[model samples]
Target chain A: MVTEKIIKVHAPATVANMVCGFDILGFAVKEPYDEMWIRLTEQPGITIINKDDYQLPAEPEKNVAGAALLAMLEELTQPVGFELTIRKHIKPGSGVGSSAASSAGAVVAANTLLNGVFSKEDLVRFAMNGEKLASGVKHADNIAPCIYGGVTLIRSIHPLDIVALTAPPLFVTIVHPQIEVRTADARSILKKQVYLKDAIKQWGNIAGLVSGLLQSDYALIGRSLEDVLIEPVRSILIPGFNTVKQKSREAGALGGGISGSGPSIFMLSKDEATAIAVEKVMQDEYQQLGLDHHTYVTTIHSSGVEIIKA
Target chain B: MVTEKIIKVHAPATVANMVCGFDILGFAVKEPYDEMWIRLTEQPGITIINKDDYQLPAEPEKNVAGAALLAMLEELTQPVGFELTIRKHIKPGSGVGSSAASSAGAVVAANTLLNGVFSKEDLVRFAMNGEKLASGVKHADNIAPCIYGGVTLIRSIHPLDIVALTAPPLFVTIVHPQIEVRTADARSILKKQVYLKDAIKQWGNIAGLVSGLLQSDYALIGRSLEDVLIEPVRSILIPGFNTVKQKSREAGALGGGISGSGPSIFMLSKDEATAIAVEKVMQDEYQQLGLDHHTYVTTIHSSGVEIIKA
Candidate 1:
């Protein structure tokens, strides 16, 4: 039932809520993504081929990719058939938006195979449904930047106002240690209420980040990227977050903090050399703990989802 | 006591927070300021000439303009004599940073007469001291705009991160009702702790406001300009705040909100005519209440503090 068309899809890894931009901003990584081969078939039912070692849900409706596709197809009455094979690169729940990448990637590939019936915005909306089923909250910070390249600012959740920012060239380094930290646990540890003083500082930092991104002022961006609200609560989950950040700063990174609900930490630098340096420091720390990990030195990626072998 | 040299100073009115931006952002008003005339004299001490009808403190440390001058003089060792005259324009406590204007204007004018020793940044730092004395808390959202024109993002209070933003061409309307709301009372009424859900929404709106200003998308700017954290708590002090906002939206305003600590409401529009229309509607509401008021229809001001006659 396989057709003559075989398409390779690349969905870039993304760091959600970059530092002070918790739940409101995100940007795409330039390298190391979960690759998938998607092909249309003459048969009526959707199929999933096993590729990665990680266990996936057998039911298509429960799988992130499958759930997203099902949601997209629900809008269309015509029976659509396709087989998807996913190669997981970024580990799930590493605070690097692994599920969002899969869900967003599948929808992008499926939409392209369907001749682009739904818009990119619609794709993001559909992907959020997948996230909702996964995490129980339809937060757009992770899904938006993965879908639309560069830095994305999610201004509102009710009507979902998301603006794609033209990012300056930033060296992004993400360190994912071989550890487990559930997002639900991270969310639970946060205090039910925060001081207004801290809230003001956070908003100020948000304004600074937005202005910094727009003007392409790297130093300003670095200075504005401090988190007084979320990072204080979340960093406790990561053993050496403060030490990693300090080392990264000493190694010429502008600044960095916990990536998403993290077991991963990310840093921003002015150049690739500095980014690599930060990565080395992270690796050194992980090695001290005698743990395996992965590090990526990437830039502000302007390209997002791509249709390969069309 | 008046000497030969006459120094004329102008301080632009500022809109603090610009809708969704609360306590962490502000921008300058182009025209109309509290102008002051200062003259070096042979007289041994600082003296205040006839100015506004109100009996402003003649003691340099007790008065806003006098405090600014004293702060400026602290840097200069040589004892100086001066006569200061004020032409008050910006109404105090209207939330358009009226005190900030007077303080910034005084320092700028004094610096002009003193051969320009203090830099703009230094002036802002000194003015923050003056603001601390005035409000019992040191914050730069108001003073930064008055000292450095255009939109200013105060990212932190400890290290004092401030970046001035060059705003796009947009019409502005500000209405100040002849009612006083003390900053201390406004500060005291708010609860110390806020719900996490509200904080999330506030941060989201702030991120939206920042992104909106950078992109220069008017509708996006309007949509993102929502303040859930501070506005709700603060608006209770101002009468007819909700109605004015509703009417302005009906009159085709992009958006509007409380200027700063309250009693003044500011709105932004795409054109001058609409700006005028919005102001008229706000004024009509004030008129209906049989209350005295003042309004300004202006644009984004690029000029900060300047000496007209040096």
Candidate 2:
């Protein structure tokens, strides 16, 4: 009955905690994705192969993709097995959702192998297991967008209420310097309490940002992309963040902030030209410091995981 | 050159702070508006008269409407004068934007007399003077919606950025329990700092609410009307608040909270029948306490200020 069993998927990179929308908003980008292949087997366990230079764990139990697939398999009524081959272009700890790309892609492919047995929400829940293993916490900001595509808002995590938000055409520019800012350290550095006055301003900016995105008001979007609470604290961890942000704005980006914690920064632009121009600004900053970095100029990826070969 | 020398305007009441969107969001309701008649005076001074039982100040500086008009006149390139006659239906200290009605109503009528010179945002700025006179701060949560005629988000007050958001059809049920909760007291009772975890939840709810309204997702809206920050402390100020909210939801209301500071509560419903049912639920709770209350079941007022007689 199994005519063809191998499935390959392209899971795009996502930028989580978009500026003012910390721990809630994210969107997928077209490039810098992971290439994942899943083979449905008669055996009832997960196997992972790392085809990239990052040298991720090949052991199924320790791997991000393996853990996520195992979680999905645990919920299935039918016994199924998956062998994942992940070719990751996104480097782990680069803060561009490298683990998310692999985990979300693995689940999407395995779900296809099972004839789409799970809802997208369920996939997100499964993927959180992978995220927890990677970051020591269960957060869906990156997973939701990587699974559902485009922009996503994780309203509540307890009941898992996620909303796919509409957005205008936007180009994303990413600059990931060769550095590591652990998610735990970044989170620990944040104050447990925030001033109520500052919180009000943050909510105002976030509400305005959401309104601007839904209405396609570009100027308003640009104006509302400011982050008062997280940026002030997290910017310290990322080297040359202030200068890069200032120079990028001078290069015509709408606005952006630390992508998923730190070390990697994302900027939103209106056009490909501006995106590329901002990319140049990002590259030059690290180049002057003699630090190696990678940059990508891409647009919003509407379809989340693409079925490359089925 | 102005043809319409005299104008009789109706300014609707607004529900501010809209649950989680403290100091940011609000919406205008259809009924319980104030009636004001403004005439272009030959003399360069503002005048006022009260035709209601609530004996508010009448002097230009002391009056809410007069202070708002005075603020507008100071910014005018040309000297203008206005004479006003007031008939207020919304009672002061009822927490439903009584001062905002008078302030926005006066400026709107005067703008007509001066051939519509001030922009809507400027009108909000001027009307904020009245709010400052009433409450100890210049907040636009009520003024923006009362002038812009829908759900309005005050993005920033420094430069006066306000956004008018689109929402689906919703019926508003208001029950004004005859008690005064001074805006200062309600604000002062709140902690100057909030837990980052609670703030995140509040922002998530507010972001969800905005997305829900934009997408017309009624279920999401209902689920997101929760306020973890302001409501917990302020709900105590309103008698029978917990029972009324609990019973209204049971009676098919979506959800809602304190109108502005409290003492008056508002609930949103899907249809007129549900709205009326929620209204009865609201009335019964206050009546059981032997508290005199006024209730109104009305839809969203699309146009904030209406010229009843021109």
Candidate 3:
């Protein structure tokens, strides 16, 4: 039997810590994905073939994609060697789950090459090892959505339960400003103890947001997008975050807030025209601050990692 | 136009603090309702009539139903008088939103008699004044569900927003072990500061529960009903709580925990047969403890505070 030489996969970027659901909910976006190519090797060690504009580590163990593939390799009964090549388009530290894309993509490509031995949930579990390497905390918020696509709820981390929720065809506007905000720093700013009252409100909004997505209620989704806890503290780290959010709402975004931990802001709209309008408002706010930013107008990507070439 | 002399309404009992939702979520049950009769009077002050089995206050201002009526009356432009008669079936301190039935029923009945003057939101706002009289703390968990029916989420207290979620036909098994567990006392036992990790899990469960209800996913609803925070503390107050819950689940209940701030334990099941089976387990547990208990097999009430006779 002849073994397949090469397999390539694409994993879309995900929005983590969606509005009211900090570390609990996430969903995938259409654009800004990372592509990975894996080739079977004779040597019994992993190697990174290319390094892009982002300063990804050349060492396989240190690299995000390499770390994920290494974790997945541990479970295989037979030893396998692969050289992984990653073309990273999703910017690192942009709060759009850049590392997750690489990690999920690599594992997916490798799993396909190895005759698909793992389930999607198993892939997510394996990919989380790399996520832990990238972001210290072994949370599945980004990886779950990046692997499953659509809106996902991380019900319990200890039990590792993830639920894929039904959602409408909603347009997304994301603006990633050219500024670095470390996830650790963004996390450090949050209070360890939140007011119980605030927690109640946050949970209520989370329930509402889930309902809004399932029901395709644009107004309810907008109303439930108010985050009283995490965003208030982290929004200060991003330049002109408030202005962009306000202008996005003014320009007809259903709702929006800081995407993930920092510099990137995202909004959801009901229509393509509103999404385009929301993008202009975000661009205008960032442009006024004389900041270079990349904005993408896209829709919710319901499917996560996919094989592009084999 | 000749105004009707009497308006009577039935307010169904509600289960508040639904598992992981703490102070924000609630849903109504079909049985154990309170009936309120309101008659127009010549005098411009409130009066209470026909309080049975419960030592309700005669003083209109201090009475739960009367207080809610007074709050609603204040919004009336013209001076009007109402004499209220309460037929209370839901017992006080049952942890089944008994007081909320009275308050919500009164406002709903009076609002109907006054020619639909107040909106449902306004009715809830006024009913909360009465809830404060009953529980000392003004919370809308019970009142919102009792007023709006189905499963309701109290998204914001400041803005007083309530979202009614669509739910499938779900049967509920409730066992009230006749013991006094004051709402205030139940609340006092809880730790003021919960671990942030636990709060995150609770909120995630809240989102999942809402999604489960909307999607009518019975297994998901059962899975999401595990409360790691409030129930652990409050369950201690109820005798045979743990055994009842364990037995209920053993008997094929979807899931269950302490209902509200218990002496009452409730379980949700997909079918009436399972609900009935769950009730037997609950009864057997409390019966073995030689405690007086009342058990009901009911379904989710989709409408709340309806006029039985006008």
Candidate 4:
């Protein structure tokens, strides 16, 4: 079953907590991704190399990538040792699914080295183990999109029901400010209990967003891209968030909000030109705040994880 | 603006609190509507005639139908008197939008006699005044669908934004048990606070249902019709509710739950034959409980409020 001597895979950065669908929806972006190179070894466990500038642990069990590979290997009948080389393009704590990209990339690379032993859904499960190690919550919001690509809905976590929604061809603009907002800090800011009235509005907007995506109604998507609950709390942690969102909409973004937790924001547009224009707005808003930020204008990643070289 | 001499309008019954969309979504049914006949009068207020078995108030300010007409009249620059005759077909407290039908029907009849003076949105606002009198809550769940037809979403109440969703051609089977479950009782039974986890699952299902309706995916509709919150509490009040739902699913219903509050349960099927099959299941379960129930096999009323004769 081990057909490949060496395998390299790429997993794209994902956007989680999508507007009205907090903790239940996500989608992949094309520009920023984490690349992993893996090769079989006689050693019993995973070994990491070329983790430049990153302070990730070299020990297999302690590393985010190693935890995912270990989880995947534990399920295999014919297990093999792997030596991984990670080239991290997505920065950690950027709120752009940096951890998910690494976790998903590692499992995908290991699965490829084993000649694709695991299904996409199984890979998502295994990748969630890495998420648990990284963020202490085994959430699939980022992992599902990183594994399946496109917009994905986590219908129920108890049964692990996930549906990959049909999305129109659209461009994405992301701006990651050079600041750290821990996932735990962002989550702790949220109210433990929400009003039933606000929850009803949230679900309605979620329904509208799903319809807009499937129907390719840009205006509907724009109108539906509103969050009444989570954003009001978590957005306060991100500096210039209000200005960035307003300016992006003013510059003709379909709509957008805080990407995942905070420190980064994303906007969706119908065309590349609008996406670029929206990126400028994001950049200018952050610049006015005297913050260093990185902007990426790209389309949605439809092809999730893929073997780049084997 | 008072151009017409007489007008007769029909407002169809509606299903509210649609599964995961509690208090925010509803759809109109074709059969079992309330008809209103209205004519301009020299008197400055609404007057009622032809009272049947129903004990509805005759006073324009206190009556559900009259309250809606009064609200509409308050917005008019040149208010006119109207004499209304309501032919009630939808029984009160049936959980099939009886009050909404009366309220929406009255405003529609009055608007027709005035040569279509108010928009549908304005009519919904006027009709909500009637809802406040009927259920002590100005909810649009039932009223929106009765006014707009098809599946409708109440996005936000503060701004009064409602979206009319596209739905597939499907048959509905409604069985109203001859027992009343007051709307106040239904509201009191629900927990003021729900787990954040369950709320996330609910919103996900709502999104899935909207996608299913718009895409005409029957299986998706069935899969998404589940409720993890409200039905658990309200279904306890309805006799043989569990058996009816299980048997209907066995009989090939797309899926279903309580129609609005309780006593009336509705099932949706992709075909008329399946709808008829599902209805028998409902009848058998209710018969076993020794309860008299009324069943209606109908389709979604696409054209909401229609002027029968003008």
The TM-score between candidate 2 and the true structure equals: 0.98
lDDT of 3 by residue, A49-137 (tens): 76588877888789888888888889988888989998898998899999899889888888888888999888998889888888788
Give the residue spans of candidate 2 off by over 4 A: A1-4, B1-4
Best by DockQ: 2
Task: Estimate the lDDT of model 4.
Answer: 0.87
Model 1 agreement with the true structure over A15-120: per-residue lDDT tens digits? 8888888888998887768898888888866687757878877467888888788888788889888888888887888888888888888889888888889988
Local error of candidate 1 at residue B202 (angstroms): 1.7
Q: Please provide, for model 1 over B99-147, each residue's C-alpha lDDT reduced to its tens digit, 9 standing for 90 to 100.
A: 7887788777777787888888878877776677678877788888888
In the range B1-310, model 2's lDDT, one tens digit per residue, is: 8574689899999999889899999999999899999998778889898998888989989999999999999998877779999999989989889999999999998888787888998899899999999998999998999999989999999888998889999999999999879999999999999999999999999999999999999999999999999999999999999999999999999999999998899999999999999999988898899999999999888888888877
lDDT ranking of the models: 2, 3, 4, 1
Better model by lDDT: candidate 2 vs candidate 3: 2
> Which residue pairs show backbone clashes in model 1?
none
Q: Give the 10-residue window scoring lowest on summed lDDT in candidate 4 chain B.
A: B48-57
lDDT of 2 at B146: 95
Error of 3 at A26 (Å): 0.9
Off by over 4 Å in 1: A1-3, B1-3, B42-45
For residue B162, give model 2's deviation from the true position in Å: 0.9
Q: On residues B1-310, what C-alpha lDDT tens digit does candidate 3 reach at each position? A: 9865788889999999888988888999999898889988889989888568788787878888888888888888889888889999999889899889999998898888877878999999999998899878889999999989999999888898899999989999999989999888988887877666778989988988998899888888988998988888888888888888888888899888877787788899989999999988987887789999999999889998888898
Q: What is the TM-score of chain B alone in each candidate?
A: 0.93, 0.98, 0.97, 0.97
Point out the worst 10-residue segment of candidate 1 chain A by lDDT. Answer: A301-310
Docking class of 2: high
Candidate 4 on B112-179: residue-level lDDT in tens?
Answer: 87777788899999999999998799998898999899999887676787888899998999999999
